[model samples]
Target: MSIPIWKYALSMLTYFVVLLCITELLRKKYKLANIVWICSLLTFPLWLMGGVSGWFRWAKILSVILPTIVVGFCRIANFEERKGSFWEFFQKGWILWFVYGMLFLNILEATLKDVSLGNYANAACGFLLCATIPFAPKFWEYSKTGEGDLICYTTVGWNFLYTTWNLCFVYGESPNYFASTICILMAAELYPIFKKKPELYIMSRVYTLATHMILRSCFGTMFLKVMDASTWYNASFAKYWGILNFILIIPYLFWYMWQLHTGKAEISFKRGKTNNNVTTLNT
Candidate 1:
């Protein structure tokens, strides 16, 4: 299928507007963690635009990579601003490296294959699944504290679902599907390392991922059937799926916004006072 220029343009514009709104909201709410969440959520556009080579592809790369690098670097250097132990550093660093490295690889793959922007965007989406893997640890750790449980579970579920959808419906034999599957499985494996209730967490992670994958596959199949029913209906099946995915994302969006708002309170409650010094985690 030939890439539609207008559709890509509209998607890019929509992405920019959403990103700007999310950024403004985060700033107003004083929520930095939401930045990452926002970046992840916004990868939808990057996925779409980067799949086909265009200005939007470059825009997508900059949007995801720049803030990720900036935030990761700041967190590492400004230990006073964010307190963590050596293990925490190691965990976050690994995630940072994974995201950045996969992003580099995605761009390189696109360049080498001389694929269309659509395929390039698909590559970007595949890389996002890769980025989500390292974050599983952090999400699992935070959830064990009895907070952000929904967000943690939902994201784990969503990425796993995304992997399944790509494999069964979008790209069964494609290398991207295989890579995404590996990433999702590896991410699920990291859940056990975060807490004492390792078994429960591991089970929950698996269930969530599996459930989401099934749901997504079913949805995709049904949607395709509906579209195949008629040619005169002017159904853009891919666009519809994209819209459905975005709508399904609303819960996570709100969950993340809440997390950002409450994060400050949680930090304040834990610290009592904002101390600009190195804070160590209990081993």
Candidate 2:
């Protein structure tokens, strides 16, 4: 793998680099590190543009339009004072970085072999994350930088949905590389909800998360052993991931119905606090 497992691990370390960028961009600390990281990330859009076709053309054009706005807004936002977790300032950046990082790995892997390594990468990620995610929160809170950070329900919900999709269809298979990275990235987002004593529904949440993790990990491993090396698709994909997701949806619906009847449920957004406080940030 051109993207060694080490590189995947190294990608996690980039969070610190983002921290340094925050520190330097605001703290005026580690200016050199900030410059290097910025320069490194800037190369990706160029690579995308060079390979431009249908979707890539739009990506390349959006790159030009979006970065200018992002840069301008960030600069203005920081002009007065920079307060909040590095995550608050750069929360969504990680997702974009993950997408770009996957693209980078795909290109690198293809350069060395006839096939794209994206599928393997996706499988490796999904397998690893599914195996480990249930343990991460018990180890430490991923989202709480200190305290008083806004609990963004949209963020965690997006991670759950996005990773779920990726697990089912990553590398267009049962487990995916993108799913793992996303699952790991989402570790922080859930911190807001769990910072307090566990609530009644929280049990359901953890159960669902654990269920999906085990589901993905088990299916991924099973498919790996049975799979033909020539094809990334398993004939059992529908039987495995499709059926598994269907099974898991039962609990979500249960939670939804119960919460709905209680008048405490919402379609989007929930805020949690360290004091066992449940506040509605959005309905």
Q: Which candidate tops TM-score?
A: 2
TM-score of 1: 0.28
lDDT tens digits by residue: candidate 2, 241-265: 5345444444554554565468553
TM-score of each: 0.28, 0.36
- lDDT of every predicted structure (CA atoms): 0.36, 0.34
Model 2 TM-score relative to the real fold:
0.36
Per residue, candidate 1 scores C-alpha lDDT tens digits across 74-173 of: 3333333344664355334344344335434543443333234243334444444443332322332222122222122223444444544343223322
Candidate 1 wrong stretches, greater than 4 Å: 1-157, 164-169, 172-236, 264-283
- Among residues 3 or more apart in sequence or in different chains, the pairs in candidate 1 whose N, CA or C atoms overlap within 3 Å are 50-120, 50-121, 51-117, 51-118, 51-119, 51-120, 51-121, 52-117, 52-118, 53-117
Candidate number with greatest lDDT: 1
Clashes of 1: 10
Clash count, predicted structure 2: 4
